[model samples]
Target: MNRPTLLVSALWLALAATAHAETAADASADANAEANELERIQVTATRSERAIGDVPNTVDVIDRERMETLLVRDLKDLFRYEPGISVGSSFGRFGLGDIRVRGLGGNRVRIQTDGIPVSDAFSIGSFSNANRNFVDLDTLKRVEVVRGPTSSLYGSDALGGVVSFITKDPSDYLEEGKDAYFGFKIGYDSSWDGLFGGATAAFGGERWSGLVAVSHRQGQETENQGEVGGTGSARTQPNPQDLDGRSVLAKLVLETSENQRFKLTVEGNEDDTDTDMLTSRGRQALTGAINDSVIARDHQSRARVSFGHEMDAIDAGFADRLDWQVYRQDSQTTQYTREIRSGLAPPTLRDMREREFDFDQRAYGLQANFGKDFSTGSAQHALSYGLDVSRTETRQKRDGLRTFLVTGATTPVMSPDVFPVRDFPISKTTTAALYVQDEISFADGAFRLIPAVRVDRYELKPQADNIFTEDNPGVALSDISETSVSPKLGAVWHFNEDWSLFGGYSRGFRSPPYNDVNIGFTNAAFGYTAIANPDLKPETSDGLEAGLRFSSAAAYASLSAYYNRYDDFIESMRFIGFNDDGLMVYQSQNIAEAKIYGLEWKAGLELGALSDKWNGWSLRGAAAWSRGEGRGPEEVEVSPGVVEERQVTRNLDTVDPLTATLGIAYDRENWGAELAGRFVGRKDRVSDSSLYQQAGYGVLDLYAHWAFAPGATVNMGVFNLADRKYSEAGDVPLVNGTSTLLDRYTSPGRNFAVSLSVNW
Candidate 1:
């Protein structure tokens, strides 16, 4: 069947099931009691505690229980069933890159852990890449995803959406009348021959509590379903690799009074990987050297220390509740590559090249939030206000050397770049923001109106030292200072107890990134030079969304439609033209406008409501469809010396195709199982005509959990049950022509994962 027909059929089937259940029995009142109880509170949507159904926008929460049941090993697994959101990958070297919401990725989406921003992703050329995969899933208590623009509350870097990760506290583990708790878990995955384990301990006293958690993991290369195995670009199999990672999380809490508390937390994570790059083992036409062997070692680490305070029900003149935190974080990524090549100047001589790239960022941040509840006549109000201030310093450097194997002579020069160079200067970025939001209710709680606004100031300062100046001679550095304002308004009308309609208008903006504003590099061998552009403008988005929701004891369903328009979108590394020196000039510029529209729907039904024979059975499904187009500047030559830049509209390649997921589950008191299917449509809407369009495919997955003992349980999952070969659209690169390496991008086939956990 076609995409539209399949989607319609699924929706019709769900509605039919719900109607049948409603007519079959009178037990609908108690059908989904457990589900209602499990999903109660969320904080990311409004920056305050509120029920998911009460929020005006689309919000999804994945708690610890869900993560465990799904056997989430990484970001990809975490979002496997979530529509309209995906994790981008960097082939097999850098693993996962960033989370894409709607049609935007990279720095457009904001990610935070415990209210602190995570490090940004940076990439230069082919060998150096620093991604935003710093969080360890083992330490998280829950993850919240808010779709659409939320800059009014989060300030910059929220043009698309926000992902908030909340970690576990000591109180979560301490039971009533118990002062201590301990837990441990171990897991294995066949896709990568991976093994992982973790342990957690918590202690509580009269007024003090403490907790410590540690986790470690080791794995081999992730396997693909490729059949060809050989050296050079023809090799479709995965390279040989070894991966190791570990993390530590510790927290201490002090309760001073009935309504006051303080907390101290420390977190650290480290990851290392070694790979034998067999794909690069062929003749290189660019340098005219035969590659014999290539190897790479990558290291990534992050550390953080934070202190926070919280107080409630003070009823002070300024606020009724106050919370604040101060934190310092450091993150770094270092990569080293070694290659041995022959067929150089003389066939008898060989050369060995070694390269190292380092990127680091250190940040200090302070945030304070206050909440107040009051009433004026018939209107009720809940006010939330906050301030955020942060300063970050970023640095990057690349060094390399080539040595002759026989003569042992060393040279500090590579083909495209020289040794000991800096891509952009040592820069510091500072931001300060203040925001206010009010939730007002009228008509006896039937109608709610939310209005919010935020003002932000951003500054970037570049320190050009000897290294940067020597690399790019006669280049002038520049500074950037800008201010932005974001606003949002939303309303919800609950005409009845089980039905509601919600709509919202939100504005978002993102300041120019430091690297994009001041990127300076020279590649004499490639006949191109990248120069800095200080006058680049910030990117902005305006979104409008409306939805209808229905909730009942037996079933729940929601459908939302959204349209977002973006202006002044920044396009990095765009080639303008050849300069006076006959070299191509590349620069980052704001020369694009785009609009994206989509529809998202989710539904669930409890089969037990129909009759006792169908007890312990349920059905759930979700789907999303989006289309986008962008208008960008295109150069046209009218005459010999006359050129014009005209706007040309084309389909956006970043937008994913229609996708849907459906699952049927059965549950008991101590054990449960689920069978799910995921469907993806063909990708034919792309800006580049030469790009390969992937065909539609569907895959099946099975998951189960059983509690063998009181404090022990085992979770298992089997993915791609049919062993079908497929690849995600985003994971596939933009190959300009028919390529033989397409099989390398295929995902793993028929993988199984099993994990065991025990608590005491």
Candidate 2:
């Protein structure tokens, strides 16, 4: 075993041994304290407020305190130490893409902020990409991540899991005796040469309260460990870029009575980027021309307005508590590219191309949830129900112009692509869902049975205007209407005060996306055409998970195993056959079956509970192992002029290899420090042999925090302490052959980040 792996194993053994050595009396006291703490840490990703330990699933919560201590600036940083979870990013161009849970990512994972879903991610070709990085970390109070399928409670996109970001409220900053509060924070990161600052103010009166928070950030391109510099594909260094971002969050709350409250929130986020694509220089495979300059300017923005109501202790015959919200959100992304090419067909001729791509979405939604507690003949029950309704309009456009510098003439027609084309028609999708869940308790809550179900209706309408028809003549569009029913059953048995056994079976499904159903494009120069497929079926999964957990004030541990089976998986842009025009045809289809299974274990220990001499010392460790495979269709040649398709089974490349993390920390009243290490196994279970296989690597990180004065604190961290040159599997693309540009995808070297916060 490697050094990091050995260290993690030793830490887990030490924690288990220490807990075993504790006296019975001490164990009982610690268990009680742990129970109380768990009860206070509530998670809302389940569609209901429940203690983390009470939920029969793998759930992780990152509160503001943890975010501050870790100095998390992006999604990649947020999930650095988390096993079975990772963020995908494109060579610093699109920045962070989306969060992947287990082996699923992209639109399969549901991402929301304050109960409103974020915009979908879309990409076409190499010049256009729209990502789902709309939320600002500085405005969030807490983040909840639910692993595995959870569609029974969250609806369509929860085929993988759910990520919920809850924003801060005025009450959070207002103390009992304080009527008004103000806070400020600043931070810097060496990885991107980034600087950020934010300010927050809250005012509270007898029945009225208000809050406003604003933040701004500026940064350069993210650094990598690449040594080679200059231009062309041979260079490994990061391309030059500038990034600017801003965010604003404002809220107003009114308490009508002790049992009722109302709130209004307005939030906006904007980001701009400019990149010099030095890598694109000296590349001209299509035109055989030397590229002089290639530049890209992109902007992404999102705005949301919501109104919500909360009521408690309502004696109305049906229930006792209620929560509802109505919201509207708009998101847009624009990418523009300007390129100049010299040494064309004529030695003295030069060409210039300007391309623009836009993707926009506007959504209106309403959600209502109710909770009731009642007793049956021999069991107590906690009943929860909710309804969700949402309508979203999605639109996309691509426009470009190619100009001959000598002639001063421009044309919208490029050989491979034409200007002013819509990849898909303007479409509107509406979804309505209703879910109900009940928890039955017996033997004084020692044993509980929970069952839940959700019914969803989805409808899509496409409006193919001139922009769409003009590009793809004689194309037929199809409307989609479908309904899905998902159900789940879970049980939790508290065998003892300090130990529990929990397990559950859940069903998840994802509706066919609009773009996939109505996609249309033609590349005559490439001798290929991509058409829409309206007969696609939704993807479904059956997941089973079980785990044993032990918790105490002094130590905690858990071991979990899960198996998931998926059917009718969607594969986009798969080659089908040749059309009547002798052009290659591609279409999206549901043609895959997959099975994934994994084991996860975590443990933590506090030395203060063992001896006074070891006070303020703690150890924590976690590890995960997973394997997956899928059966899909692959084209094969039967004879010289005949081709056929066959079902093939291969390892799923999305699943990461064995990974583990270990951390040791020392804490005092005013200061604390932690040293953490991460270990990853080699990635070799891939279907494509030509893909780059990353080797096993180990990295260490150090973090520290100090509160030198009242209401003032400083946090700092150094990541990749060994300056190792490594690459995450997700960041590396499949290369056709032995490529010399592999170093370009390596992760950053040693870097530091620091932040300061003050309140008055």
Candidate 3:
């Protein structure tokens, strides 16, 4: 485990309660659950507690009540339901996850924790959390996913959209007359022989309230066994990660008066990973793939502090919020020697360390909103305005070494042997940004308009001397500075209380990484080449979104469509011949243009009667389609020495064709049950140098619960019931190399877990 792992020992206790079976739970507890189903659904799309229906944009919300019984642990488990969204894991661990929104990648899909941006800044996988193996999935309230281009509120990365991880706020769900809430849970997984346990406590009063949670888990190996139940799966990705993780979240709320109060909170994330992979020497025998075993260790830590205040006025209010944070991350990789039957080469050892590498971000921003409702020229207007600013600095190190492996099992299922190699020069970076927004509602809220803009100035400083020297130069010396402007416009017309129509236009972008701009190093940064293009430009998008929503107290439904125009897309181009260090490296270059378009539809309704017995049962469903393509592009590099401005390859506008979900849920005072199924179609997505056209797939999940004792009960279910075979993944295509040797599993197979919980 890395050094940061110990810090997690002190944290909030949020357990992913699990049970293998799908059946009715305890009785009176079910009665207690009935009240929860009827409560209001509050979302932070506009930084306020407003009914989801009131928001004009398309927002996917998974409530806390569902979060509890469903046992959704990581990003993948939580987001697979939305067609407009796709998720991936890093090293097959829960500590890390990648998200793609509206066919846009992670960096463009701004991720926030409690409305604050919280991802790795190294620009490697475009996420700071990359080195940390598993992301802690504990007591979370709900995840709010804004589908489509969201350049208005969030800045750069909001090009694709935004996903805010909102953890449970202690005072909202506590029992009446009780000072606090306490819960404990224990569970297990079949894939990795993994075991996990956690606990949580929350306290509240008329004026003050707070919550804290903690959780931990240990695992040996997890099976990959591709697409189970089809032919034969018992597959494996890498067992290199001997993993342990912990997280803590704390918050305080103070009520100053009836009209206002204050809120302060803190969050921490840490992971300790010791990875040692297990693979087949000659797996397929047909394709003659090569497999290799290995070991590695890494660590990560992130901390954040936030404060918010609100004051009431005559039918209006003034709200102010401030958020700040500091984060540090490190990664190291080592190769060991081969033992017996691995007569491919004599066992060798190499050391690779990424030191002097620190991801630091010092950001303190303020957002002040002055909102009011007044009659003006026979119309009522609710106007709000605010400002936002933040700065981030990131650095990378090549202090890592490589070595061969020994004492580990040979590559699995008859795979090829191993060969040793080395590369030089690591990459590093830093950035800063500032912005503002204004929203307006006219004619008694019949029509609402919002316009916002953000200006960002980035400084890309690359320390070439650290990895490369003036004598053995690849990158030599290069530093870059650039500025960007993003704007948003939207309007919603409430035809009536039960219906509304909305249209939105937004622009978003991302600056090229320092490594991608000035690294003369070989590929191998994250096992892929670290290409640099000094002239690389920022990626930009301009999109138009239109939608309609028909909602009532008992039913809700929505339909929306979007079209995106992209400019100067940043792509990691294909690699060329061996460099001075005899290593292959791909180039990070910018493209002219790309286009994306999509549609989404969703509906919900109450069912099973509204009276006694089956009173709270409801049915819900949603569907979406998206496509991405390179437009008016140029340049083609043929083998040898031929370069021509070719139109491009794989510019098909048919990626992520369709995604849909159907669910049945029972919400009661104490007893509840839910069953949801999903189907996603094939994707034909592409970029500058490659395209990934994959077959679509589907899965079904079952969850149900009942209350037996006063404070104890059981919840159970199955995920991917049909044992579906599918990949919600995309990557730059590979060459003639045996993937079995260097590749990692991208998706999880049919798996199940069970747990019991006690709360009083």
Q: What lDDT does candidate 1 reach at residue 742?
A: 84
lDDT of 2 by residue, 1-760 (tens): 2633554465457546645635422433533332222343655545667776788888777788878989988898888888888888888477788788888889999999988999999999888999999999999998888888899988898988898899999999999999999999999999999999999999999999999999999999999888889988677898999999999999999999988999999999999999999988996787788889999999999999999999987987677799999999999999999989898867546889899999999999999999899999889998989999999999999999999998988899766677899999999999999999998899999898999999999999999999898887777888999899999999989988867889999999999999989877777678888787889889999999998777776777777789989899998888888999988998989999999888777767666666666667777777878888999988879899897888999998888888889898887788999999999999878878877788889999999999999989999999999999999867877764388888888898999999999999
Find the number of clashing residue pairs for candidate 2: 0
Output the lDDT of residue 449, model 3.
76
Candidate 1 lDDT tens digits, 664-732 = 999888999999999898888888788877778999999999999998999999999999999876688
Model 3 TM: 0.76
**Reference-based TM-score, model 2:** 0.96
lDDT of 3 by residue, 440-501 (tens): 76776677776767677666665444335532344454566778888877777889865678
Give candidate 3's error at residue 190 in angstroms: 3.5
- Please give the CA lDDT of all the candidate structures: 0.88, 0.86, 0.57
TM-score of each: 0.96, 0.96, 0.76
RMSD of candidate 3 to the truth, in angstroms, is 10.3
